[model samples]
Target: MNHEFMDALNEIVESKGIDKDILIDTIEQALLTAYKKNFGQAQNVEVEFNRESGDIKVYSTRQVVDESDYYDSFLEIELTEARKIDPAYEIGDIIRNEVTPRDFGRIAAQTAKQVVVQRLREAEREIVYNEFIEKESELVDGEISRATPNVVYVDLGRIEGIMTRNEKIAGEIYKEGQRIKVYVVEVRKTSKGPQIIVSRSHPGLVKRLFELEVPEIEQGIVQIKSIAREAGSRTKMAVKSIDEKIDPIGACVGQKGIRVKHIVDELGDEKIDIIKYSDDPAEFISEALSPSKVVKVEVNEEEKSALVVVPDYQLSLAIGKDGQNARLAAKLTNWKIDIKSESQYEEELANGTLYAKEEKIEEEIVEDFEADEAVDLEEVAEFEAEFAENEEIEE
Candidate 1:
């Protein structure tokens, strides 16, 4: 029985990658539980396991007491009897006496097996969780393993991650064994194990894809300021360059739009608009509403809003199908955009509404500047007069 137990212990340690000392500790606990269950009594017993010979020992502890007070055999022992058993046994000393159970090898082995299995499973879950926690919000490629109508599981090498219907790109299809890139939206530790939530529709996925495709973006030569995505339909991105020499748009677009084309292909032919990011709201709003020429842009700094006026012929193009272009531009710029045709703007202008509002705003700005300048002149004049009076007093 000892030989068989040794072999099983070695096999479990090697196969499960569990530590030997932890296995010993676990088996000791299992034996204690089994001894109590089978013996039909709860006693103050402790189990000791020797790894070298796979030997097991059980010991029971009792407090020494006077002969008349000895009532419980498991908890107390007569002092006179303890003295005979060991001459140095004291009254308050915790004496450990061996009480190994008879024919306990089989029961102990069965109980240890159950515990080892449970411990091994918990350890494996912890390992997997630790490995994936650092990968949250990262992009990784994996193959589809299993799928239902609403959920698809991807084989992520030591673990499987799931992508839900909402995380999937609209109109995109998923097939078993097909490989695709995914964004790790979250890594959560749950009762079952690590639940890695992945996605293909997040705007972050677009930014990460660009980082992977464009070396300039990867090296931080160009930064993607914002992204607006309709997932499998269209996307708008604004980019800027830290180095004046490197053209952010040209680098992202690549030669003949090859760089962007790869991203578009990966997104299932989603239309992409790569616009140059500008600090000026007028220039930025105009650039965001691309593929259509803009006649003028009026910005309200206080409200963070813009009035974009385009030619009447370009209004439909600027707004696009169902106002998608304008909507996406608004999202990307984080500004309230009111796009108008030249004729519409002209009507507003003639009714004195647009012009009057503009004059009021401009007048407020001019008044603020004048008030600040007047305050500055007063302080300067006072400082000079004080300096002149001090020089006369010194003389």
Candidate 2:
């Protein structure tokens, strides 16, 4: 029994990564509790446990007095009686009586065992919590262990994490036993276990994945300027290269579509456009609304707005399906884009249209300036004519 107990304690220490000395201290506490409960509470008791040998000892202390008041482990031995036991004994001294393991019964052992197990589990939880607390927003690779309509269970070795429906890329599929990488959106402790929230639809998921796949991004040679994603459908990213030698778009797209292809595969074949970032809003907006040739871009810097003109034939393509393309492009470029056909834009320009009323704004401004100048000239002329009339009257 003693050998089995020692083996269990060693196993717990190794498996839970708990310090043996702390375990020994906790065991002594448990034994002390059990001794008080089983025997009596009034006795001054101390408990000790040897971590190496798993030996438990209990000591009961009492004050020495007269022999007439002798009691079990609490005898008040007289001065003469104590001198007989030890020649140099003193009055009111505390004498300790050691209790053997045999003194504790089955009930005491069972109670102490429960206490040890509970304390060990608590310690293990603290250790695991501390280990993963700082890794909340990191990326992790996990295998799909189970899949449901609303959530997927991913096995992250020591813990299994959950990827919920909203967190998943739209229309993206998952299969059991398939290994997939995910972003750790959140880490929380629950009554059951550590609840790790994973995501496939987050914008940061793409950013971090690119950071992993693209050496340029990892080395800071290429940086993601902005990303606008319609998950599982299409994603547009604006990337800028720090060095002139590296093409940010080409680095992201790799040789013959290898780099982007890997990302596409992970995203369930979601189309991604890796457009090179430009400082000029016109150029950047034109690139963002790609695959369609842009004839002109008129930017309104004050309002953060732009007018993009494409050929009449490319209008539909530039606007995209259900206006998603233009909407996402606007979000990515931080501009309110008004995409129009070249013919339509030219017609509006010819008609001289503003947000309201088509009028030649320059002609109106020139008329107002000329009118003010004429009014000042008329005032000067009237003053001269009045002074000339006064001189003629005086003559």
Candidate 3:
């Protein structure tokens, strides 16, 4: 090592963010090991480095003992010889002598090279791990690097993130070099390097996309209450507005639906329903089953379950194909939902198999009566009169 080597070392310290003192200490230790391997191991030695000059040196140490007490020449020196080197040397004092080999600089260079390279690799891995750990549960843009039968690898700048089969959007084909957005599901450290698990099917990806598109959501004027998704098919999101003037659904949908359209395009045209969140569970459940009109929602709060009634014609739409719509709605509202057509609900009411809330039934009857133009006036009047009489009789 020399002054020129110190300059290069300084550059590495600055560029790699490595501690200078620690690197020097590690180099010294490496040199010590090299010295023992090359030279005889019979000598007790310590290695040192000159910070200013970047010079490496080795010293052999021996403890002074009386000639009669000295049993090992490697560990103990006769007091007479110690005193010859330094007249004032006393018994039990340690004597150090420079034993740097004539060609030790070459050996020191090789040892330092190995140590620096190893440290650099370790530091880079740590940097990458820490950089990505903070990004877990966040969105990232990457290019598809390659794909296996069960995994897709994405180039996320400094590292490749793995997206497993379960995390991929169904029916969507990925190609190499395709630019896409992914959700960072988790970050873990492994022996090879940092393992980043990213996802395209996570519901959080939808939520994050909304946050990116809707200024109201990012600014806290609108809050996303919940999201339920069947990736590549449909998703239901409930949102509420903190400011009454700002409509949460409109803000998320953007003017002319441009904002949501961009998100849909990004998601390969997955359908998304942006519904207004409600404090009332019944109202929220009704909104969650969107595009399929809900006639009524009867909730059992204690059981976290709901019985939903839809028009006969809207029953299939409410339940969706294979019950997907109803399943997503239940997940969105955290309630178990039982869907029934209006006629089925009426049949259950008559059979006394389903218990309906009294207030909800009264509200439905009143609503029916108010829409007299849609139904026979005499029938509405008779039903209202009968309901009132039943209530009075019960009271």
Say which candidate scores most in lDDT: 3
**Residue 73 C-alpha lDDT in model 2:** 46
| Residue 363 lDDT, candidate 3, scale 0-100 | 86
Scored against the true structure, residue 188 in model 1 reaches a CA lDDT of 91
For 212-288, candidate 2 gives per-residue lDDT tens digits of: 88999999999999999888888899999999999899999999979888888888898898898999999999999
Separate clash counts for every candidate:
0, 6, 0
Question: How far off is residue 157 in model 2, in Å?
Answer: 2.1
- Candidate 2, residue 52: lDDT: 61
* Candidate 1 residue lDDT tens string, 1-395: 38677888788788878898887887888889889888766678888877877788888888998787779988888898899889998776667888887888777777877877888888799888888888888899999999888999999988988999999998999999999999999999898888999999988899999999999999999999999989999999999999999999999989999999999999999999999999999999999999889999999899899899999999999999999999999999999999999999999888977667768999999899878744777788999999999999999
Q: What overall lDDT, based on C-alpha atoms, would model 3 receive against the true structure?
A: 0.93
TM-score of each: 0.82, 0.68, 0.82
Q: Whole-model lDDT, candidate 2?
A: 0.82
Backbone clash pairs for candidate 1 read none
Compared with the true structure, model 3 gives a TM-score of 0.82
**TM-score winner, 2 or 3:** 3
> In terms of TM-score, which candidate is strongest?
3
- Superposed by TM-score, candidate 3 places the C-alpha of residue 154 at a distance from the truth, in angstroms, of 1.6
